[model samples]
Target: MNTQEYMSRFKRFYWITLTALLVAASIRPGFADEALSRRDRQTGFLVVAEDRGFIGNEEIIDEFQLFAKTRNASLIFVTDERTGKYLRNSLDRLLKKGAERIVVIPLFISAAAPRYELVHQLLEREKLDVPVSYTRPYGESYFAVEDLADKFRTIPQPADTNLIVVGYGAVDSDSERKMQADWKRIAEKAAAGFGFASINILIGHDKKKKDDDAVARTEKLTRELADAVNGDGDGGRKTVVIPFHLGPKLDSMMSFDARLQQLLPPGTKFLADGGSEVRADANSATINLATWLQREANQSQPLAREDVGVVILSHGSDFNWNETMREAVQPLMKQYKIEFVFSMADQPTIERALRKLEQRGAKAAVIVRVFAMESSFRKPVERMIGLDIEGVAQDTADVHAGYGHSHGHGAAPSVPAPRIRTSLPIQTVGGLGASPLFAAALLERARTLSKNPARDTVILIAHGSGSDHQNELWTQALEDMAEQMRKSGGKEFHAIRVATWREDWPDKRAPWVDKIRAMVEDAKTEGGKAIVIPARTTGQGPEDKFLSGLEYDLGSGFAPHPMFVQWVDEQVRVGLARFADIRRTGMTTVEAKSHSPYPEKWLWW
Candidate 1:
């Protein structure tokens, strides 16, 4: 190669490398810069970050820019490096683009990272002050943990794997403790999603420290890895190491990979190199990091209790039935702000209700679902509200399309389905069907018709589901309610039986209705007055049609009862607590079996 040609190519490569290491870069207010032009109001995000030491992953970085654009926010990505001039310039440019204020987010995985104070030092140097707000670092984000778990799912059998999570540590002793606590939570969240047989969490520092504790930890981990590899039988269990470490240069990753090779067991799968290799701008290029930014922006304006609202999701019915639900819900509005959504988790209806709540200045919403079973229409509603992942990744390409998730190119402008777009932070609490409170309420209804407990056979019937599995769940719920009722006051009743009318499907309805009729006859023949109760949310249903000439007195359903309103009030409280936890911890999984209804909950899905 000629000297002139070689020198020219070297210069180009060097400048490209240097610019990528810029420590600080800015997307102007509302991305109004000519290159990313969009004239929109801005929320300010000063994402405190460090360099991600890998290459070839600009697609993730673009997602962040796309997020910034959609968020109508100004993002000034900062690294606590000697880039004060660059930092100042980005800030100045953002302000010049008309952002009213700046929110400085130390976007580290741990708040204890020593360089975080560098942001303050750099800011002090400029001294041209405007309103500056600070939210906590990205350490507490549950979505970031989810991102790790997303990687964990790649292993063939998560149930048999041992997980080792390496944390990027802080230098300060107290900071390190706090950082470790956060990392432990991160690991726990990941474990909640995938069943890792065992998990070990260790803080991985930029520079290795020479200390007894660090040495002991290393020895213990090394011994475990070795034991796993050398174990008998079907060989040792597989180990998966997830590192939270990052660095400014490519060499850092190479060293990390080498160290992992030594620390990991022989059969371990070390995926330091992946299909989506980090490139160009690795530090500010992750959906998790971007979500952290979005979370910070949301938390910037915490809602007052009065500013938050409530949503009651119920299965809708005809005029009189619907009116009964509306009337029952009226008293709750006096104590709390509420919107009643009467639909079987219809997405468009939910979107309309959530937006209406947002328009009413509700920054947070407590959504309470009322259904015959917790599993009924719950997943679809949860998915709509971002509580669940859209699908099981079957037909992954198609699944990605639903969320506007693009590969190798860019993110789609908008998501088309399975999610509703709204600014309100929502936390849903429901499965009233599984509550002891509902059981007590049912008992109250039975009490009104019981002239003699010994001679009474209470028949609890519900408007049932079509799926045999769901019908089974419905049966269990009824049995649970019957048990609760027994414990409450109905113990002396001859028997409390449960049945479903299979109210909707014609193919199944006839047989179930016949079964319903036969149960009344059995009660009558047993010399007990049959007290048939519609365990519904409103007025008594088609029991009159089926029970026709059979002599059976019907008890009122759950509506208009003081306990029904009490259940709503109690759920509001739970919803509020969950919302607080989500906002405080930034967990995206919502309630993951956190409030699971029945252990056999899997049958509903």
Candidate 2:
């Protein structure tokens, strides 16, 4: 009853314990090399990055993986330019690996609605023989916009100040026509939140392709819009231009907000809506992006520190936004060991971020951007990082351009940086262009237009002009939207398919009216839709209204990223809140990446 029975019981308990350990090891990562290996072979998610191939996708994939890891989800990534074979192979691979529930999210923005039809067709065909679900691109996600708004809400507020949202506004085609129309609506609704007597919205335009010339155009546009806001007798109004761009380097280059000070109507007051290139506010867009991702992952525990980090990339700015960006990302610095670096603009860019992480101590890094599309951004980011992050680069940008040719990310030329070698692992996540949160922000912005009780033809515009080889492609792709709107049920709209005077519209020809008439006719013939959109990224100007105003019921407007506006507002508030946080927080938050010591290495200097 003592020794013999006790020995027998011990033997049975030991066997039971061993069995439990084996089962636990099978379900947990790092338990056995074979365990993770087995899961990789079985439950990996299949990602098809149908992009123009930008480096940003690599970072998005890395972040998505990290997010999955935090939630103990495993995935296998497949990156490829969009093609039928690629999609078929990817689906086949996932199906063969026993994928039970697959969610296919296209990285392109314009493809959002069209891709749904494609997915439906494929699913009907039963080509993959698996349950595959397709999400409406990245930026379409509501959380994307909400997170951006939340981040903006965190910025400090100014006392008794008026804010004007500014961004690249000019449209050759119509990718963001709906978004522009939507943002105007959002602006009108914000009065209840901001408590301003009346808030005005403006978009900046690039009169030409050259950066300096574009700057001039932005200045002129700002002055004109300012006049529309508060100026009396054409002197123009005094207002703050809040940039709504994703990357500081690029934003500062063409964004009206950055050039507003230089472009202000002579003698009119213009204040920095937020911080500089190295301030937390500068990187608020990325912060909002990450917040959206964390939610997407739906983690049970807090997000893994490895899952988030500062991804400093430029859209190739001539004036570096690195220092200002560093400052903007400071809030996360103390918590995350810098993990990644690269630029959409400059060279010594993302490469430096990765090397910096290796120099410090990081197993891997996640890369992301606050932008909305992923055409050119993917290749550069991938070249800087690599395809090892589950090989499934994710991004917020929308991927498919309805008829092909998409708008790729851009920046100034890159400058090379030092490299480091370490055993620590690294991976890349891509752009956050179409993240659901960003889409929600667009919707919020759309609400702003609803405030116009007069029921005018809301024309949303952007400032777009570029000398780069890609500009023409973007212009053609962007400006032709009457057909798309007609397809979507919009009619009687007066939209101008023009680039900035700086980019391509300098001729000032009267034939442009013929173009306007063509679009109206197309809209009527196709869908009986009537509203016209100038869908530029910047602001509205005489040039923007050029031929359209003479037509029927044309009203001009701009669609700056609503969250960006909110972020600027928040930055102002944060700077003013508890002066201690302001002073102690440091004037700039940029941290030197271990791989690159120069502040401007990742941006144009």
Candidate 3:
């Protein structure tokens, strides 16, 4: 071989070796898995807090870090004080790292804060393709109320001690007004937990000129604090002041507190001010977020082997609606292992959920029907769960058929026994029928839309069952609700009527449409407004579709309301009590000829 030929051969071998190494690297297990993992990881979180200074900002960042660690999610922190450009830059970094779904949580005290609007506007300008969700600010949650109450309990005081909280007022007039309203609510909730003689909030800065009028406003607030402490007729009451700030150690907050203390009356005392707006030790916002993320993560896990398993049964359709149901039941997740089973339109049917629960070693199970009434839906559920009817009249003529029965027909069809039986005892409970909590939720929905009850005609609308008998039962229940409301001041309305989506047989829903339109027109002719209330499990349902283009106001359905949760909790308690009774009496099963399960009428309510 000549020198030129040897050099050419060496170059060819070098190229061939390089190509082989590249192919090996591409096929390596760990390297391929890492790339796949990066592609698959879609969820991330962005936490934004108004950064006044280091102490407050660091606390928030630390809390967010804890949340991110627990959720195994990527997190980015930004301050509202920075320009929108800066926030966009930070968010861009997260997106580049392969986060397709981002949840933005604002650390502000109120959901109405202007910072949220700014963040939203920035997202629009960037026009990011990934889906993003924004959580309402920290103060809106029931957990926040409880956290505030717990903080108030930590303040050592006499029974007659008055409480005063001071906060940094917003510069904008509208924001300032909203902040005042929100703070007043927080104060009321906190005071309710303790026997405070009185509670009030004083702003440390002026809304018109945030920085320029700070000193003058602090002086004014100090004087107001003095009056608040001494103006009450009961002269012996002492006043305690707390810096209601996200970062109390900030220079401005420290100066304001010092001035207020100097001007306070002799009997007034100031609480030790060190923590942020939310107590670091108490239910911090980050801690709450961590818990929420954990619960969400648990939704995909195999059912835990536990003492009790709760199956939240709902008539699920849209995936979004199922998500809403999941969120609504979050508070209960901490106490019991939970699995959701949809009656329709979703995976993991009731049969599947029960089998999973049994496999997970659940000693007993509870079926909490997330519905507004016991109607056609309940029958199938009973049959699926192996519950047997007991102690009802067997004769076709004598059986207690639900309300509007047109009898003298032939013998009733026989209901097959439950298809699946489990060793674990199961107790199925009725939906939110005729419960006081349900009535209260309905009233709240009505009052929210009513401009003037005395001038507005209110209509209670529900999704009635396919059976005429079941429709009659629903109508009677709504009538009973209307009567209760009428006795409790709902009579102030011009009139109240009960209407159902399924009024009769196949054409039942057709009549209600015209009836609703006429009712609205009649109310308009009489110089009154009309309000329609959706008496169902959730607000996002047929009411909007049926009442489209109508001039009347429509109210929301019952789920996600605190009262709805209360109703669910009450049912759980009742189911457990019944289960205990059954065990004590050694009654494994009840037998009746009727197709409907459960001997007791209340259980079928």
Query: For this target, which candidate reaches the highest lDDT against the unseen true structure?
Result: 1
Clashes of each: 3, 158, 1
The TM-score, computed over Cα atoms with residue i paired to residue i, of candidate 2 is: 0.31
Runs in model 1 with CA error above 4 Å?
1-75, 83-295, 299-303, 389-418, 583-605
What would the C-alpha RMSD of candidate 1 be, to one decimal place? 12.1
Q: What is the lDDT of candidate 2?
A: 0.36
Checking candidate 3 for backbone clashes, the offending pairs are 246-277
> How do the residues 1-605 of candidate 3 rate in per-residue lDDT, one tens digit apiece?
54244334433443343343323211101122234355334554566555433334344545555455423243332233344555565566556656676656556665445654555555556656776655435554333444445446666553677778766636555766777777776667545535677787765542231234544554566677777766654667666777664532223332334444555667666664433333233323334444333322222122323556788887676887788888887887877767887663122366678778767756567788777764434544554443422111122211113323322125542212223434345566656666777777888888888888888888888777555665677788899888887877787889988877774344667876787778877877878888888787875447667777778888877778888777777777776776655433321111221342212322211
Model 1 TM-score?
0.55
Instruction: Please give the distance, in angstroms, between residue 580's alpha carbon in candidate 1 and its true position after superposition.
Output: 2.9
Those runs of model 3 whose alpha carbons end farther than 4 Å from true positions after fitting are 1-40, 70-81, 155-159, 206-210, 248-265, 273-605
Q: Candidate 3: count the clashes.
A: 1
Model 1, span 441-531: residue lDDT tens: 8888787888887878999998766667667667778888888889887888989999988776778889988988988898888888889
